[model samples]
Target: MITLTDVHKAFGAKHVLQGVDLTIDKGTSMVIIGGSGTGKSVMLKSVLGLVTPDSGTITVDGNDVQRGDRDAFLARFGMLFQGGALFDSLPVWQNVSFRLLRGALKRPKEEAREIAIEKLRRVGLKPETADLFPSELSGGMQKRVGLARAIAAEPEIIFFDEPTTGLDPIMAGVINELIREIVTEMGATAMTITHDMSSVRAIADNIAMLHDGVIKWTGPVSKLDNSGDPYLDQFIHGRAEGPIEAVR
Candidate 1:
């Protein structure tokens, strides 16, 4: 469903993505893993065209991202950012249905609210929570709201950036399971970038380890433990003394 070939991105002299090439098949979940300063985020942004690549091609369903109808291209994708990134001022229902309330998918407020409530329910949230602000929710609840919002539009593809970053382990596990279930049930292509190992095991069908600006390993999650690449082995095992240097 998505392909990046020799993608390169840099901010002046700081090279982020030197040459990132990855292929994500349709109806599958692929997680990009890497330590900090690796190009995982840059690679994702390159695909989203959030950060235009200095060179190379990024295609979704065979169409180059930079050569598409901007809004139409974006309409096919949903994103849940690292932080919940909810609009603080908007009520929960509005935040959940943000996309449905505006632009190409705009609908009557009542209809939008209905859809939002259903999605919130899907993410295990109570309908009455809709009228509350994001601040009123706990971190886990906030994440669920974000997840509900992401699937509210039911786009063909989803991008999850650090889905379990701030939550406790149990809450993170809940989110990981929800993501896996939603992606499977919807049959949507998914690309998630995260360093959380528990999340990696829960959400990935395929795992790609991005390191030094290129994919160092690409294989099924089942093969991750035996990939035998030092960088990946170091990462998955959380070894302090290995090719992957740990901060002091």
Candidate 2:
């Protein structure tokens, strides 16, 4: 399991996370939901070590994240950035297997290319598209490529940042289902940050609500609609007249 105990973080005078205690069971999908500036992304970043916490203990499978080999620890996880952060100069296959081509997970060039193509196919992309550049694919296709890359290494954990941010509703739904399928098939621990309720419903096994520098509520996805927390109700329902400030 991935556990965060008493996690806290601040930037100058602005405090973000405050004593966040979250537990993500192994092989389950946990989606963090919150309004803007509620520290959702910050919390995710802290777990990834992109942003260090002021005080806390973050552990994966009982291994302390901060006290491990950075590269080896990271090798066990994969991240899908919000905007499909693909390199324009590399072909789709190269982008997918970028990690496999070098570093700790390095493989022969031909083997890496093969794995990339296989992963692309897993994400519903054609083999021929492997030779194309990111600029040539549509927004949805780009997201698929991003996902293929995320799963290319078959990491034990995957972090998704705004999985469906720019796609149309149908495409978004497709991505959500694809994510669910991939996670379920691989039994990978997933932590996703999204404001998309449709995505939360389709992808999460458990949901946690982050608000006002703390987690207001955390429970199974089935409990979301009836959680009885005004903050959660307001945010999920997209209501302007509730506990949450309308302008925040």
Candidate 3:
């Protein structure tokens, strides 16, 4: 459903994504895992057209992302950012239905609220929570609201960035299960960027490890433990003595 070929991006003297090539099939979850500053986020932004790549091609369902109509292209995707990225000032319902409230996708406020409430329910949130602001919720609840918003538009593709970053272990597991269930129910194509090995094991059908601005390993999630790549081994086991060095 998505493809990137020879993608390259850099900011001034710092080169990130030297050449990233990946392909994600329809109705599957592909998780990209890497240490911080390895360009995982940059690759995602490139696909989203938020940060244009210097060179290469990104295509979604054979539509060239860089050259497609911006509005039409974006309508195909729903993204849950690292920080939840909710509007603190808006009530939960409005944040969940932000896309449906504007432009060509606009719907009656009541209808949008209903959809938002339904989506919130799907993410394991109660309708009562819909009237609250993001600041009124816990971190885990905020993440659920973000997930509800991402799926509110019924997008064919979803991007999850650091889905389990700042929550308790149990809450993170809950979110992971929720994500897996929703993706399966919708048969949506999913691409997630996260450093959490547990999250990868829980949510990924296939896993790709990025290093030095390119994919170093790509394989089935079940095979990650014995993938025979030292980098992959080092990352999964959290070993500090391996080839991957800690940034000073």
The estimated TM-scores of all candidates read 0.97, 0.98, 0.98
> Which ranges of candidate 3 are over 4 A from the true structure?
none
Write the residue-wise lDDT of candidate 1 on 1-248 in tens digits. Answer: 89999998888888878888889999999999999888787788788888899899999989999996999999998888888999999999999999999999999999999999999999999999999999999999999999999899998999999999999999999999999999999999999999899999999999999877788889999998888899899999888989766972
lDDT of each: 0.92, 0.94, 0.93
Name the weakest run of 10 consecutive residues (lDDT summed) in model 1: 239-248
lDDT of 3 by residue, 1-106 (tens): 8999999999999889999999999999999998999999999999999999999999998988888589988888899998899998999999999999997789
> lDDT: which is higher, 1 or 3?
3
Candidate 1 local Cα displacement, residue 243, angstroms: 1.7
Clashing pairs in 1: none
Give me the candidate number with maximum lDDT: 2
TM-score quality measure for candidate 3: 0.98
